[model samples]
Target: MQVSGTFLAFAVLSLLTIGGAVFMISFTRVVHMVISLGVTFLSIAGLFVLLEAEFVAISQILVYSGAISILMLFGIMLTKHDAKDEGVSKANKGWLSILVVAVFFVIAFWGIQSTPWVAPPDNAAAVQEDNATQLGVEIFTRFVIPFELTSVLLLVALVGAIILAKKEEDNE
Candidate 1:
């Protein structure tokens, strides 16, 4: 039997996403890791499209692949690091770190399995029409304070990053 296009697309995107994540973690160079992260974000955006979430897909592409990836690349460039350190950073206690991760995964898996999840009703068409307007209104009117505060927080972080990037001897 021939497989459906949607299922095939989903499988390809899923594999790509997982591969990207693995590459992102395994890559030693900061630039390579950031590029891998972009791959993951783009694949996830494709998955959102497959799920008929056009707004979410666009947001994922714009916010994650476009903005966040660029931000991460800039952050990497702004920070000082020795070019000779080509190897990926490793924890001193590798076994303990692995055990902690395993335990965390077990707890997360148990929580996921035990949770009662309710699937939203499939009214994609209805939601699609007003989603943008609703989202904008809520963000501006209801969540304006939080939104502005986040802007301030980002500004502070940017200033802090700039400050950190400066060499003390150069400053003098």
Candidate 2:
């Protein structure tokens, strides 16, 4: 019973997340788009919780919903004076795009449903567990170099944003 309830919850959240994403993309108003994005992030976090990844769920909420969404909202605010007037145009071929996407989804779903998934043998399972642990350890240690590089990239992006937002001395 509990498992079924969780599955239902996950399904509902997934639908909400997709709906929110669609709303975000379709809305003309920047504020409405931001709010829809927040809904999408929160729904995804709920999904992570349902998947038993508590740490990842919290991080998703903190990083995406809290920090990234706020950053995007701030960017929108700084870049545009009138929110409703900006990005008001919808795609001219939206119906065609939707039809193509639906056909692709149906084909992909049929292909996936036809697949046979097999569990690993005992020896393969042992190797898989060891490999997973080793991969995690390596990511935490040797891969720190790439991680630090990515942080530096983010810092550079922040600096660029500040430069762009700065008013000229004459304007000030």
- Report, for every candidate in turn, its global Cα lDDT versus the true structure: 0.85, 0.83
TM-score of each: 0.72, 0.70
Give the residue spans of candidate 2 off by over 4 A.
1-3, 85-92, 119-138, 170-172
Q: What lDDT tens digits, residue by residue, belong to model 1 across residues 69-140?
A: 998777767675422235525766767787889999999999999999997788845766656687788799
The prediction achieving the highest TM-score against the true structure is 1
State the lDDT of candidate 2 residue by residue for 1-172, as single tens digits: 2568877897899999999999988898888899899999999999987765566788899999999899888888877845773442467676778789899999999999999978757675454344445756777899988988999999999999889878778864
State which candidate has the highest lDDT.
1
Residue 36's lDDT in candidate 2: 96
